[model samples]
Target: MPIFEYQCRECKKTFETLVFGNQEVTCPMCKGKNVKKLMSAFSHSSDGKFTSSAGPGCGSCSATSCGPS
Candidate 1:
């Protein structure tokens, strides 16, 4: 089974679901059927470094400088 993330359009709630097969998906918060699957990031650590395609800062800072110069 794969874990899928979904965001509710009705209540604006985010949640995850473990799907085994083709089935109907609904928001757990408001039980609304209007939901959209979100493209989440997968992370892995190798050679003592963390890398991801989500870029740096994760939206914390908008500055161009990264770390102490």
Candidate 2:
């Protein structure tokens, strides 16, 4: 089972759930079933350290102008 993030439309609370099949998702705070799934950001690491070509801020710095000049 994969963990997925869901935002409740009624109470605007964010929660996570392990979905196995067509299960009805409800908010843990308000118990509202009307929820929307949000795309989660994830990173995998084996040696506890990971590096990428993208500097930071989710690759938003495409101009490469981040520095202390």
Candidate 3:
């Protein structure tokens, strides 16, 4: 089983769920079946500390320069 974050399409609410085999997912707020999985941010733990994949803003951009884009 894996946890996934979802945004309800009907009520516009955000929620998380632990999905199992063939399990139906729905919003806990409005019980809406229409939902979309969000592009979740990733993180990792090292030496008992946590770090995010998208470090600080650091005025950095992958496809474009740090200027106004």
Candidate 4:
């Protein structure tokens, strides 16, 4: 199960939820069903390899999205 970030429209509180196959999504605070999924940042790990989520020519990019060496 993947954890997703959500914002409650009713209470205006941000929370995390574990989403499982059509399961009901509700806010932890105020128990509000009116929630919106947020585009949260994520990271992935590669086994013993250098990875760059920023795609090619990451050295020239301003953002440092490339994983550590």
TM-score (all chains, Cα) for each model: 0.55, 0.57, 0.54, 0.56
Q: CA lDDT of 35 in candidate 4?
A: 94
Put down candidate 3 lDDT per residue, 1-69, tens digits, no spaces: 387778899998976678888889989988879999876523531332222344443334454344343
Score residue 9 of candidate 1 by CA lDDT. 98
Cα shift from native, residue 6, model 2 (Å): 0.4
Per-residue CA lDDT of model 1 for 1-69, tens digit only, reads 587778899999987787678887889999999999887623531332333343654434665466344
Task: Identify the runs in model 3 with alpha carbons over 4 angstroms from their true place.
Answer: 41-69
- Which residue pairs in candidate 1 have backbone atoms (N, alpha carbon, C) closer than 3 angstroms, thus clashing? none
Better of 2 and 4 by TM-score: 2
For each candidate in the order shown, give its overall lDDT on alpha carbons: 0.70, 0.71, 0.66, 0.70
Candidate 4 overall lDDT versus native: 0.70
Q: Is candidate 1 or candidate 2 better by TM-score?
A: 2
Could you tell me which residue pairs clash in candidate 4? none
Most TM-score-accurate candidate: 2
